[model samples]
Target: MSESKSYTGGCACGAVTYRIDGDPMAVRQCWCRHCQKLSTGGPTHNAFFMADAIAVDGTLASNAHAADSGNELSWYFCASCGTQLFGASSARPQMRAVRLGSLDQAHELQPTAAIWVQEAPGWVRIDPAMEQHPAQPPAPPPQNQS
Candidate 1:
């Protein structure tokens, strides 16, 4: 069998770092207003993985708020440089969304879906090949537990 792939990355200032074993369960671009605000008017690209797959080091700061779906969402960042790191939702505590920009540059992952398209700005042009969702789509199937 092939060896499981591992990905590594850290915050802009290198104060926080993380490693993820295996591949991501899903990659998506979110255009929700909250995401836009976080991304400075652009979509937030994320790679969702089984929460257990991620191992982080160093202190992290976080902010939690209720989402439109009623799920409590929390964003984690490097306390020093303020670089966003990961996001988690109460609706799927077993999953964690790693900000794409936080992943190592060598990683090849890319968003396969665009969600909350209804909230995308008129000037934004989503890739025609990507699966589009006017709003939140169904959660990704559960990852292997073993």
Candidate 2:
């Protein structure tokens, strides 16, 4: 839809290089507590993308945590500098939540939505135009039927 969109990113050390073929999902700033704590900046903002749409090279270290959905989310970070790069959830195996800061054009991405706003600090404000979901989006319709 966006002129065959494409994007690229990598780890802090640049050992790992990655690419995305399509437009990102929700380019938003997440003010959730976990995000605030884990993020180097004031809060954790990211440009989410479909896992299937991403092509990554190199390696990364991950830490799994229980997400609000009661599923374990694998947070992939650079083993070298501990820079969080992306996240993948077991519940939605088809999506990869890439940290916006890790992208080559991070500033170009503007958040279109907000999630977990309740946890957002008072200092942060979000646009009302974006859709706000209490938690991760519902799973897309099952592609195959048993």
The number of the candidate with the highest lDDT is 1
Question: How many residue pairs clash in model 1?
Answer: 0
Taken over the whole model, the C-alpha lDDT of each candidate is 0.92, 0.75
Query: Model 1, 23-93: lDDT tens per residue?
Result: 88899999999999888899999999988999999999999999878999999999999888899999999
C-alpha lDDT of candidate 2 relative to the true structure: 0.75
TM-scores, all models, native as reference: 0.95, 0.79
Which stretches of candidate 1 lie above 4 Å from their native place?
Answer: none
Residue-wise C-alpha lDDT for candidate 2, range 40-131, written one tens digit per residue:
43656777677777888888888888877688877888877788889777887887888887887644687767777877767766678887
Give model 2 RMSD, 1 decimal.
3.4
Instruction: Report the poorest 10 consecutive residues by lDDT, candidate 1.
Output: 1-10
